[model samples]
Target: MKEELLFVRHLHVEFQHGGQKEEAVRDVSFDVGCGEIVGVVGESGSGKSTVMCAVLDVLPQDADVSYEQLWIRGGKSSAAMVFQDPSAYLNPTIKVGRQLIETILLHPEPVTEKATQQQKKNSRKRAWEHAEKLLEMTGIRNPEEIMKRYPFELSGGQQQRIVLAIALACRPSLLIADEPTTALDVTVQRQILDRLKRIAEETHTSVLLVSHDLGVVAALAKRILVMKDGEIIETGTAEEIFHEAKEQYTRELVEAARKHGSRSQDKRRISETILFQAEHLSFQYTKFHFLKKKSTEAVQDVSFFLRKGESYGLVGESGSGKTTLARMMTGIIEPSAGQILYLKERWKSLQKGRSKAQCQKIQMVFQNCAQALDPKRTIGEALTEPLEIRGGGMQDVWKTEAAETLFKVGLESEILEKYPGELSGGQRQRIGIARALMLKPELLVLDEPVSALDVTVQEQILQLLERLQREQELTYFFISHDLNVVRRICDRIGVLYNGRLVESGDAEQLYREPWHPYTKELMLSTLTADPKKMRRRRNVPELTSRGGTGSGEENGCPYADRCGYVMECCKKERPELYRFEDREVACFLYSEQHSGKRSKEYRMASQI
Candidate 1:
């Protein structure tokens, strides 16, 4: 057997919190061989990230770190890390290119031979070139344009790619990616993972990928480490983890991942009465150049309806027009070419004129709670804004209601007096939820509401939402990339791809039998906690080039490029919605000619 690129033997990490010793990492041991991808899987507070931080010597000064043995490549070890939150890790004020170039220059290789000095200089130049290539490889459209931009100017996905590019600039033998793709959309995530895999293969670099996502780990990692509460509970290959897990926690994690793609519910009749409808919903943004002009169609010809007391979910990868559609639903951005009808009353008509009561009927909770609330304002003020805007004059009564709402979200009333900055991410999210509840809206649009939360907090929020829906008879339009949360809360789900609804059906039915390829891929990509089951699953195939049209162009099947069962008509003619038992799928595989002929092919592909 080849020598491992890196090894960790009996590592222990701790911290002194309030003068008491707290073990963050306990007797953890792992190895990353040359060109190997080792994944660390765990929920929040599992100390997975803490182990990586300890290895990098990036932990806080007060952190206590001990290790029996630590070794790396070439009999000398140096490593670099890419953090989970790019916004917190990257310098917001500096140009990304400059920062990357500076990082490369700062890490000069030890020159031995006289001729090696010139070789090292050449390596530095190659490193800079590789940095630009890395950005492009990671799916950033224009590398030069992105490099010129600062970290804050880029989107979350773009920032993550930039950080990844910088981490690779040093040409380190071992790289640590800490939940690097957690904030990315599914498509972007697929692209990013593919790039990392390719880089690792080409450079023979080892990777320690820490993530809560099981699907990501399955796709990229060969060996798996399952952590719970700062301890390694299980270790195995991907197939063993996914298929034959022995631990109860491992089984629960597998079940969660398996459940993500399934929607099992007791048969509940869905009424035909549509409470809210969006007709020809279209939105666009203008792009101004010196002399050229461009208009980006974010949401085009999108139409959907929400029934009273029904939970509807919108699912899609990043930039697939999920958030844009959510914004239109909440009246934050008016549709450029469509009408939003609330019980036969158009939003345009309401915009021209409407009562406060009518306006208060719709409310939204955004993805980022920290940015949603005013930093200077206390939580009390933030929660009461909607009430004040609607002229709900009973301030004292609403204040009491606000406290109750906070309490419902597992928060104390004392949190009301605290500023947004003073609250934790989870607390701020609850405050956002509290503010939305205060409006007493008939339809609540939750846009990726629980994506930023940890699993435990997410469970609490899910239960809270379910309870509120039952008690208040609230209709929800829940938007999320997390299929597990969607399965747990949504009654019906609408799968969107590049601004079009490719699939929609009862959540349970859809999960059990996902007809659309995109939907299936999304389900397959989600990770579970089980070590044995995860190991049993095969590696996800790399996304193939979809050589047909631009993203915004109208298509029969938006996923035709990535779909494994593509036909001739899939390229030229777009597939229309075809009924599949209880769901609707837009794919030629379900079309007339290939429907029966493709059944075998579909079964074979489904095994993936």
Candidate 2:
């Protein structure tokens, strides 16, 4: 009974790579109704994104697209798109406010009467005001100040919000969001998701959400379209597609979502041997301006120890200093204060010929191994560089270690001759691991290692890492913003807030019964692939936290501004770690546990 916003039939697209023709999309047919949200989902290389790109006319010229029938009822100007990476799409040099208003000025609304220059000026001013409102609608706090900033000045969530504001500036009848909230943390993601839902409901706008994450797509879409190998596998309402898929591929995807989307409660073994320790580790970076100086304390007096052969997960929203802590632990950067002890010996720094064993005992894996590897170097050279730099008497050792590590990672021996670009993402990541194992490290610091990968690929990498740890007795310091991914691999976890360790405990206990108010918010923000759960999330109360979390202020409890149980003392002083039954929580409510009766209210609060 609703108007047809978009319709397509027999849509086909193909590309020629290395003289072999490849089909990206085949015989796809679907329609979007006014005020409806339609989701297209699949793993990488499934062509769901390609179909959306084709409609937007942003596909590369090398690809060919054709269809028997394709139409947008109100024409091209009535639609706008938000991309996965707003940094790539937005102009870095332009102020956000100017760009937001420019779109509205170019695509002005219908005017009934002729206007003079003065009237046009007034209209432009009013348009600027409307742009601010759009920013606020997208859940951006301090809209007026944000408008004056450039794209790079904003956080990932802020940039995405700005992009959404621009998309809605022209008042488009249709919105195309391609992985809009994929890289965001849980809090920011919930805000963006709720904003989009409200926009579609209040304005009667149509949405075509293209994503590989079924949970993200399910959070908004009513109807679902499954794509695989450039073909449509199934089409139905969310409930039907999730519960009763007709095709094997659709079932696999659904099953994968059910099994792999949210992390299961970990049941893994841990060692009692303390392999690494740091006491009161703190780090700071100073910035110099025009006759003025500014400093940011990236890490506070935070301390934690890793048991031998245990996976310790670090979870936090981005800019919460998780990566900074990882870097310090990896010895890539030294802590401005505190002592680092490995095997009961303190390591001052990784200087040449000083504590070589300590350096060898610690290794790190970066997020994007493909980017981390040099394109021109073969895998062999990369694997040997660590040993080669240490005065070169271990040539035979290097060769033997490279071969053994490659075998350990389940790669063929012949891959040593291939450049990093010649391998798949998984293979390249394996090589990164092999390189780290050149000296057979006892500890590995993995920083968002699988955050950018597909779900299947993520599972593969995690299993490989698990096998390696089990066989080699490795200790891991895993850092990521994804709580689910953390639960999938880590036995124990720590929650970081504004460079402070707010909570630490068993992964299952933390997710199920978080103590800190910030931890509660984080658990609530995690999205799962359950349609019913997502529907219920719509009724959940909005987080009380103010939007921007990019600021690095370290005066009090980093989460005081956002805590649901905030008090006057929360803003005045920082809380130290207090002992609980099986965990440590940094909160005043539990500070005096020596009497075995921490505040009763806090006991109730932790159950929340």
RMSD over all Cα atoms, model 1 = 5.2
**Tens-place lDDT digits, model 2, residues 1-608:** 87898988999999989988898999998889988999998887888789988777778988999999888877877889999999998899999999999988888888757798898999899998898899888877788999999999888989998999899986888899998988788878877887898988988889999887777877888999988888888999998888888888877777766665456443456778888998899999999989789988888888988998889999988877888887777677788898787777777765423366667889999888988999999898899888887555667777777888899988987998899988987788888888887877899999888777766667778888888887888889999888888888888899988778989998877877888888888877777777778888643345434332223344566667677676566676677897666698888766553225545565534633
Report model 2's TM-score to 2 decimal places: 0.92
Q: How much lDDT does each candidate structure score? A: 0.77, 0.82
Per-residue CA lDDT of candidate 1, range 114-218, in tens? 756778778767766866887776666677777788888777778877888888767788899999888676656766777788888988888999987777787
Looking at candidate 1, what is the lDDT of residue 572?
67
C-alpha lDDT of residue 447 in model 1 = 92
Lowest summed lDDT across 10 adjacent residues in model 2 is found at 543-552
lDDT of 1 at 536: 62
Candidate 1 weakest ten by summed lDDT = 599-608
Which segments of candidate 2 are over 4 A away from where they belong? 18-20, 112-114, 261-269, 351-354, 391-403, 538-555, 593-607
Best-fitting candidate, scored by lDDT: 2
Q: What lDDT is reached at residue 567 by model 1?
A: 64
